[model samples]
Target: MGYKQRISLLMLIDSLIVLVSVVFSYWLLSPTLYLAPAVVGISSVTLFIGHHIFAHVFKLYKRVWQYASINELLSITTAVSLSIMTLAFVQLLSFQTVYSRTLLVTWMLHILLIGASRFSWRLYRDTKMQSDKNKKRTLIIGAGNGGTLVARQLLNSGTSELYPVAFVDDDVTKRDLTIMGIQVIGNTKDIEKVVVEKNIEHIIIAIPSLIKCELNDIFSKCAVTKVKTQIMPSVEDIMSGRVSVNAIRDVQVEDLLGRAPVKLDNKKIADYLTGKTILVTGAGGSIGSEVCRQVAKFHPKAIILLGHGENSIYSIDMELSTITDGIVIKPEIADVQDKQRIQTLIEKYEPDVVYHAAAHKHVPLMEKNPHEAVKNNVIGTKNVAEAADEAGVTAFVMVSTDKAVNPTSVMGATKRIAEMLVQHMDMISETKFVAVRFGNVLGSRGSVIPLFKKQIEAGGPITVTHPDMTRYFMTIPEASRLVIQAGAIAKGGETFVLDMGEPVKIVDLAKNLIRLSGLTEEDIPIQFTGMRPGEKLFEELLSENEVHSEQIYPMIYRGKTPPVNVNVLYDLIEKSHHLDKGELKDLVLDIAHFKTKYLTQLSLVE
Candidate 1:
């Protein structure tokens, strides 16, 4: 039946019960003397009207019958009290004391009976709903606040597909106890057994503050179970007051790395990018595209995407256009090495900030064609920095690598030269030129994560360069965010390096990837392919001679390198430009030794 019809029926039944109780009380109080039928009927009608009016005003009918709580009980009490008061006032005014004051006491008992009856029906209906045949048996991994909140939401929501069967918590004291009607089964160690016993279809990890390492361990344990698993978003996400079911996304590659999230100063970052015209060179590349995405959040006045690849550039442009509503994003096809084209574009756009991410980054490829590395990584950077200076850009940031700290690969040497070029240019230019350097970005194109994933998916024999090889890793988005923040804090001639957490051994990384994919070491074999040309066993973010200090941002560090004579450096680069490939290699080799002691240490590590 409809709610209105049901409420009307309840009201009628309650009124009849109240009338009967009142008549009985009158009989007991004064059996020898009886009131006129007319007076009794009038009094009954008056009481019913008073009760109905007070209940309606109190919104008693609006309460959800099945989910009634203490709040609803309070409302019922107020409605009943007002009804009794109205009836007493009416009796006193009419001088109807002949009816006896004992009827008023009976009316109070009637209110309690009616209210209890209504609440009892609601409780019975809810219990039946919970025990319905179609309810999904689910397990909650934590019995903390977040878990309790999730359980409450599920219970209150009648249309939800999930039912809380039990909870799994680490606290021994909580075991075998019940919370919000759901029992605590055991700790996470017992998840498999609990899932099997309870026929659980889903498991929810409700600990938002869990570290990645703990999450990885939990995920490993849960991966074997048939139940689908989900996690609560991080505490920061919840604290921001943006919590929702949709925010709880599937576990990603980043989660397996066990790296902590990067922290930033929003005020400083916003102040740097807001309303400024920003340009990202190589905007279509993995790191470059992420930088574009991060910068767009700051509501830049305009963002110019400078890249040579049309398809990559077009894809990033479309992606950014869809995401950025108020910002203007202009994609231009131009090679950074072409000084004339880069100069023209910069002069036209007059970008307040420029992120020079255009370079040949692949180590083996650069090693095979060393001159090309010089052309793109070294010369291209010089061209862009010069153009930014000529156009009077406020800041120019060069996206560099940890390899640049020491020279090993042609790619590394070229990048180091790029940093030197920028440092030298900063001495002459009014624009603030800075280099932001870091190690590998996880899940980027051609990165170890994707390579490992492909190998695992292809079945057996995941290849690693060497068993001893290790490299620092960070999420693409985190690295990109740090780059933008670094730009905001850049003064002339400073190198901002990211504190990429502990370096991960490549061999161990492969094994972990295999395990994360639900494969055993015996099932998925790891093969060590000899190291690639120009590849090093380890990478460093700073040279031994370089002085470093903490930045305002926790993950970012500023390094002070010895000043180079710009005039002499330019002359040397010009000389190398005229040399043959063989001579150039020799010149690069000579320059490599003079660079830093980190290079020799890297060689030893290799």
Candidate 2:
């Protein structure tokens, strides 16, 4: 039955218990039949009616049995007390009533007994729900307020089905104590023994306020146990009073590497994109699609999806169409390198802002085909920026990468050149040109996440570039949303670098992914495949030459870089028309290194 029906049944049982108590008290108070049957019956009926009325008013039946708290018990007690007082007044008014103080005292005792019985039943049911024979035996890693909160939620939720057997706290005083009926096994040093002796299936980290080093240490302990792990969200999230059992999610690969969540300012992002028409180039690609999704939420006037790939464009168009019914989402299949086509689209749509996300981003692939990367990323960016400027667009944003900062790879070099082009264009154009640069997006195609997941699912060795190789990572949607926000906040010629939480070691990431998939490192072995050509062991967001300052948005920082000569850059780009592949590559490499080489080359070539 539903909760309300069950609660009604319990109330009926309580009334019967009260009636029995009253009879027993009356028998003891008077040996003879002094009280009239009609008066006694009337009093009993009045008490039942009063309880029903007060219970309804207090919403007692509405409380979920599993989630019942002390507050609910207090409400129940208040309702019963009020009902008893009303019964007492009724007995005084009736002349035929044998008003015995003993009977009244019995009624109050009965109320306490009945209330406690119902509460105990609810607690028993909640505890029983976690008694699945095959349920995971979990060990919580903290004993603070946050940990206790998590424990209470888990015991009450009746979902998730995780059974908490013990808590591991570093505090010596709490080492032998019990919380919520579970024993505190020991400090961090006893993690291995606790896991082995208790047959722990999982380790739940309940320390939301833990620092990076402490978290890393806990993760190390968890790794030795070879148990699956989960983590509670931040303390602020819990303190904001929105924390729930569902907030505890599987520990991500990023957490083990000591990465914290990035803080973002919502107001700054909302101000720039809301109520504006935005055009995103490469709208079907990983980054572009994410940008489109994020932009749609800001209630933009319209979003034009412009990309060369018809299938990719159509897929995102269909997805956005389902979500953004009221907002205008127009998809156009056109390459950014086609200046005439790009100019035509921009003029026709008259977008307020443009995000040029189209690019060849893979390092090894771009290295083999530098000409393609240059043509698409470098030249394509130029076409889009120039067209947006000509069409009187307010802002032009280019999606860039960490590889662009002191790059050793062709992809990185091309992106750097693209940044240079935008900086140069911004000087002479009315349009505000800006670039947003960051490191790899997790789960995007060509990213390591999906690749490792696929390999592990296939029951084979997970491949890593090297044991020490590391890279900065951000989720695709998070990265894209920040990109949209950054675009809106751009004034002119600012390269906004997003704050990627931390650099994750590739080997460690693979291992965590294995455990999260319900497997061990032994089952899914990691193979160290040496680094690829032009790929770096680590990635940097900004070079030593660049200095940064906080922008209006917390997540975004503006880089201080030398400006490019507009006239000279324009002339050199125009001259690039006559150069062959080899000459173009040489020209791009030379131009990318100098602060004003493009300007000098343009003047000389022109």
Candidate 3:
């Protein structure tokens, strides 16, 4: 409705209600007495004027009544009460007497009629909008502000297909309350019962500020109903205009697996990264690209995108170019394994900070091709670290893995050797060298989540390595941001382990992914394959000897794993080519585990 028309319609209805209320009170209270026309006319006019004046003062007509609540009711009551008081005062001044009984009755009637008239629009809207039976019956989990916001949007939205049927809150005080005509049916514990009783087809976790544990608890309740569940967009996103209030998103496996990300100290990051040239090897890979994205936000002097693959480097370079202007983004198609090429780029760009993310990470693939792991993970790290040292880089951050701890696989041992290589470099080189170690990245290229999704899409048995195999998981962004944060606070030779919260079983992860895909175990069954040759039953972030008691930053811990003997590390790099896969694996594992024992064991000597 037009603003002026709406205001006019409300004013006319209010005028009629006022006149009727005044007349009814006068007839009922003083039928035997002489009902003076002057008294009724004066009472009605003064009351009407007082109501309108107060309505303007309270912004009564400005409020959208269809989404009204107690606040609106309070406004109506105050406006009506003030008008009645104004009438009583006018009567005393004009006639030297006040009709207390008649006036009291009139005030009661006026409040009732005025409140009903305003709330009736809401009633009509709810009835008209909710009459559509095709909309999905949605149960909202919170009854607080976030819950009401979702409900109000659903009620007013012609575009949305969700129809909020009821609310369920854990707070007992909010029970039995009606918001926007939707009742608070029960607590979260009653989600299944309420879903069955109300025929709820969908559920929304409407509490935006819920912690990880709380959200998981609420979702566990909703999951029991086997209903498709989603969470409302966060209040920060809504306030920032990045998304609408109703732009709710589905719950993903990452939400349940990891704890809250550490808050970065921006000033600390900016001091090291802002306007300083950064060279990120494997810049096109998952963690590498994300590091570039996060680094760009710090406004680096220039970003050198170094990677082996041409397309991945090109893709990330173009993406960075579009998001930012005036900052130089240089893409170099050079393999980190090629020492000469790496040194050439390092000399050309002279990046202040270098993030060495290039690695051969797949456990099974690296196990079969241990030589590749040696070339890319161990030797590649040496190439970059040496080049950075030669170029006088300020900080060199090498990306390591949780598998590097107490290594069992060729991949893990090679990465462990790489970690030791960097720490050894930190001892002699002027550059501050550190390794940021993390476990499985949830959605990285070739990560388990994508593989499970593909298997689910293919409508087959989703294969898990083992029923008991567990690993720490973090989102790519969390891993990348912490990697950058670690570089900011680098003291030489330290291994920064990102706090991954807890380890999740592979079977549990598969089951959650399947259920979140809106499928039950019957629809898509899970199969347990034997663990891979290089895989661990469970991965550890740090070995027993490397455990620390305190955190350097939130969600980041200092792991002081002493470096391997530099001679054995050099021996692995030199003898890796001549040794077969089995011999290579044994040598790398030996070097990774027993750092000093390699000198006594001369079996790997050429």
Weakest ten-residue segment in model 3 by summed lDDT: 597-606
Backbone clashes in model 2, listed as residue pairs: 572-602
Candidate lDDT values, in order = 0.80, 0.79, 0.88
The per-candidate count of clashes, in order, stands at 0, 1, 0
Best by TM-score: 3
| Candidate 3 C-alpha lDDT tens digits along 1-606 | 799999999889888999999899989998743368888889889998998999899998799887677899999999888888899999999999999999899989998998898888888877876787789999999999999988888888877889999999999999999987799989988999999999999999999877776777787777778899999876555765778877789998877764876678899999999899999999999999999998998898999999889999999998999998778999999988899999989999889999999998998898899999999998899889999999999999999999899989999999988887888889889999999999889899989899999999999699987889998898898899889999889989999998888788889888888878888889999888888798889888988889897988888899887545576568557977999988888889988887456745422422
- State residue 494's C-alpha deviation in candidate 2, in Å: 2.8
Q: Over all chains combined, what TM-score does candidate 3 have? A: 0.86
Identify the superior model by lDDT, candidate 1 or candidate 3: 3
Q: Mind giving the per-residue lDDT tens digits that candidate 2 earns over 1-606?
A: 976678878787867866765666656765353265755676577777887788788887666655666788787888777877777778778754546575566567766776776687777775676657666888999998877877887777656668888999999989889887789989888999999999899788999888655787887788777788889986756665666634888776555545455554566666877788899998999999988987887788899999999999999999999988678999999987788999899999999989889999889987777778877988899889889988999888899999888777778878987898898778888889889887888877799888998999999699988999988887776678667766667788888887766687888778778876778888999998899977899898877667565555666677846666546655665677577756765666666666344545443421
Candidate with maximal lDDT = 3
lDDT of 3 at 65: 85
Q: What does the lDDT read for residue 547 in candidate 2?
A: 58
